[model samples]
Target: MRPPYFIPADRTIDYQLRYFQAKQLHQAVVIDNNSRAVGLITLEDILEELVGAIQDEHDFA
Candidate 1:
């Protein structure tokens, strides 16, 4: 599989959400100042981070 999309920590939630959907991306490696992965951000995590919700096909509207 290809690497997940990377975004800066300061990125807006809307941008991240759109990126996650358009790319069908499940996870990303959050990088730090030295251009190294410092943490991971999964779709599940993003959903939780944004709306405190969980994503599932049945929940799509």
Candidate 2:
């Protein structure tokens, strides 16, 4: 697989998702204030998160 995609930790969730989808990155690195790696997020992880969020919204509705 390609090297982990890197995204700034401070980026908004919407921007991060758009950027990752645009680059077709399988995974991403959430870089921190000191430019240190804080976490790794995969495409599958993103999808799962989205699904969970949708379910939550649906429940609330």
Candidate 3:
């Protein structure tokens, strides 16, 4: 497996989005101030946060 990309958790969503696009990364590991793996972030998550929730057929009630 490829090594995961790590990004600072303090970064803005816009910065992270650009970084992801530049590297063609779908997901990344979030690093906290202590350099610990604190969470995971995905391209979809960034888009959704920027544009609000996205709905698809799978979201049907």
Q: Tens digit of lDDT per residue, candidate 1, span 1-61?
A: 6966676666677877888899888887777767787787777877787778875786866
RMSD for each of the candidates: 5.1, 5.8, 1.6
Which candidate achieves the best lDDT against the true structure?
3
Write the candidate numbers in order of decreasing lDDT.
3, 2, 1
Report the C-alpha displacement of residue 13, candidate 1, in angstroms. 1.8
The Cα error of candidate 2 at residue 13, in Å, is 2.1
Quality of model 2 by C-alpha lDDT: 0.77
TM-score sort, best first: 3, 2, 1
User: Which regions of candidate 2 fall more than 4 Å away from where they truly are?
Assistant: 53-61
User: Who wins the TM-score comparison?
Assistant: 3
Better by lDDT, candidate 2 or 1:
2
Candidate 3 residue spans exceeding 4 A from truth = 56-60
TM-score of 3: 0.86
lDDT per residue (tens digit) for residues 1-61 in model 3: 8789999999999999999999999999999999999999989889999999888786875
* Sliding window of 10 residues with minimal summed lDDT for model 3: 52-61
lDDT of 2 by residue, 1-61 (tens): 5766788888876787798889978788889989899998776667676665434444665
State the lDDT at 26 in candidate 3. 96
